[model samples]
Target: MPFFVYGTLRPGEHNHDLFLRARTRSEEPGRMRGLVLYEGPGYPYAVEEPGGAVSGDIVTALPETYRELLAALDELEEYAPGDPRNLYERVARDAVRADGATVVRAWVYVAAPAVAARLRAEGRPIEDGDWRGPGDSRTHRRG
Candidate 1:
């Protein structure tokens, strides 16, 4: 199965090493639409938006490998699977890479509506280029 990873989970980031440790493959840069990237206190989240987009990477992992990846990511995000307090959920999404090819089957961590609302109420709205991998310092503009 393919998973779409944004934030620190992207390649070359701190969490990327964990994903690599999980033995995932077929990694490639990708973008998902209908989500806005927000910068929280220490990380980023993708809030669902009708016409927004979030850039990330596409990775293919075996179903069994999801267990390890989930554990590592949940730890990093301070979230637990099936926990209501968590702000992200694994969901199927479609993504297109810079090359314009469509990846129709991928799983991505999407921000929960309640979490997004709470963040907005706290005055942290989604910002362009809010999501970045390790060594990615170039400011990304919304397209």
Candidate 2:
């Protein structure tokens, strides 16, 4: 199945290794509309808005590998699949690439409502660029 990954799970960030380890293949850029990207304390989260567009890459994994990828991601996000406090939930959503083509049947990590409320209360505005947090230069060392 195709999964939309933003944040560290994108190509060369920290969590990208995990996805690569799972043998997942990534598509070109795609976006989720109506969600504003907010910087959480440790990572990034998205909040639903009237007109927001969260962009990221779409990755496809084999059905047999989906569970493993999900498990790894859940752990990385400090979230359990069925837990209430979890910030992200797996959902079937459409992703629009830069070319304006939309891909359906993709799973995405959408920010939970509760998490969004907390972020808003903390007065964190949605960042305009890649949400890599403060002190993180965009450079990554190749292994």
Candidate 3:
């Protein structure tokens, strides 16, 4: 299954190799529209907003690792199917590849509205949509 990631789980970010690298079949740069980025304590949250866009990676997980990968990601993101503690909701959305030509339907994790409001009140909003580069101070390199 294909999924979209714009934060710590992105390539070269904190959790990429630990969770996605080995389990993925292919990876590509892509962008998801209609989501704003908010910097969290040690990460960034994807909050939906009209006319907003998020730049990220489109990762295709190997079929055999799909279920296990999703389970691990759900745990990492604190997303239980019906749990109130769920901060991010796993969903499917269209992503445009870096080349600006291809489109793919990929799973994306979005901040629940309530959580988005909380983060909005406490964290800095990344108006640019991208969560990479110097703008993301929460990211730490792997040693």
Candidate 4:
């Protein structure tokens, strides 16, 4: 199965190597539509939004490793299955290659609307809907 990662899980970010690198069989740049991104404390959160798009990568994992991969990412994202207070919710969405050549169903972590709104009110909303990573200063406070 393929999973779309838009934040820290992207390659070279702190969580990628530990969570998705070896676990995934392959990776390619991708983008997801109708989602807005907000700058979280240490990561960015994605939420549904019309006319929005998020840039990221699609990571393909072996079927046997899919469960483990999802588990690790869920833990890293503070998302426990069926938990009411999950910081992020894991959901399947359509992912398109960066070139817009193809689209595939891929799991994605999205913050609930209320949570995202709260975060945006307190911090900042990634207006461009792209999240590089925490270590990249280029992603924040542009002014």
Candidate 4 worst ten-residue window by lDDT: 134-143
Which run of 10 residues does model 2 get worst, by summed lDDT? Answer: 134-143
lDDT of candidate 4 over 1-143, digit per residue (tens): 59998877888777788887667788999899988887777777888778889888899997778898888888888888788788888898899987898999999999965686686578577776777635673353242
- Tell me the number of clashing residue pairs for each predicted model: 0, 1, 1, 0
List candidate 1 stretches off by more than 4 Å: 62-67, 74-82, 133-143
Report, for every candidate in turn, its global Cα lDDT versus the true structure.
0.70, 0.68, 0.84, 0.81
Query: What is candidate 1's local distance difference test score?
Result: 0.70
Which consecutive 10 residues in model 3 have the weakest lDDT in total? 134-143
Question: Which candidate achieves the best lDDT against the true structure?
Answer: 3
Clashing pairs in 4: none
Candidate with maximal TM-score: 3
For residues 47-125, could you state the per-residue lDDT of candidate 1 as single tens digits? 7778888778888766777778666666666566688887787777788876877656777787776887875566354
Looking at model 2, residue 119 earns an lDDT score of: 67
Indicate whether candidate 1 or candidate 4 has the larger TM-score: 4
Ordering by TM-score: 3, 4, 2, 1
Please give the TM-score that candidate 4 achieves against the real structure. 0.86
**Candidate 2 — which residues are off by over 4 angstroms?**
127-129, 132-143
Tens digits of lDDT, candidate 2, 53-93: 77678887767777887777667666767889887877777
